[model samples]
Target: MPEFTMSEKIYREEVHFTGRVQGVGFRYATLQVAKEFEVTGEVKNLPDGRVYLCAEGAEREVVAFREELEDRMSPFIRESEIKSDFRPSSYKSFEITR
Candidate 1:
């Protein structure tokens, strides 16, 4: 695990999850998990039956959050595509968007 300090870098990840992700409380569950971590961003259902998520925070927290979420929701997720980048933080909290 990586320890991040206020002076260290923050990372952002854009994730798209496919499978039984829609209509299965996926976004709500993701929001619940997000609250447990120090991450900020949003989760929403796409029209193509995928769940899209954007999270930004300390790199360790964001990665841990994603791992825990996947562990808890593995039964519903068939495939996940993740893209990560370095960017300035833009969200104050995590949310479930439409």
Candidate 2:
């Protein structure tokens, strides 16, 4: 797969997912799912018991990533809040952050 340039990212958003998302390999699964999309981002566990993710890509790609994430993680995600218009971080690949 080709590396996605920062310049190619036109949509960026941050998501906070609540519920059983912490101990369920959420970050790792997120990284895996990310491998299928041409997006750049990071996923991490938050101290407030939510999973945080920031993804950037073309609008369609980023939105699809979010949809798939929700579909695959439906059982674990109880609530989620998505905030669009996040500042791009120039991430080269998707990752799980400590």
Candidate 3:
């Protein structure tokens, strides 16, 4: 039997979602979705009425998590901007920041 190993590059994504993102359970819903994925970071409501999301994990997992989040929160998200880069993971768990 051939030995197999799995390795994936980890990355961090900073996403800003605007529109009815604040005051609509957006942060709570994001927290719930974060629990289902293997990513770590935080989500918070910005003063400018945008939801700021910072997540770091395996590239594939992070991407999937983002996609799921967008799908689940589509109704409240009118505009979204994403920026990604290779960053050392620094969070122990996902959280909602004030």
Which lDDT tens digits does candidate 1 get at residues 1-98?
76656555569999999999998899999999998999999999999999999999989999999999999999999998999987667788999988
Tens digits of per-residue lDDT for model 3, 1-98: 54433333358899999889998999999999999999999999999989999999988989999999999999998988999987456788999998
What's the TM-score of each model vs. the native?
Answer: 0.90, 0.86, 0.89
Candidate 2's TM-score reads: 0.86
| Stretches of model 3 off by over 4 angstroms after superposition | 1-9
lDDT of each: 0.92, 0.88, 0.89
How good is model 3 by TM-score? Answer: 0.89
Name model 1 segments beyond 4 Å from true. Answer: 1-9
* Candidate 3 accuracy as lDDT: 0.89
Minimum summed lDDT over a 10-residue window in model 2 is located at 1-10
Error of 1 at 52 (Å): 0.2
Ranking, TM-score, top scorer first: 1, 3, 2
RMSD of 3: 6.3
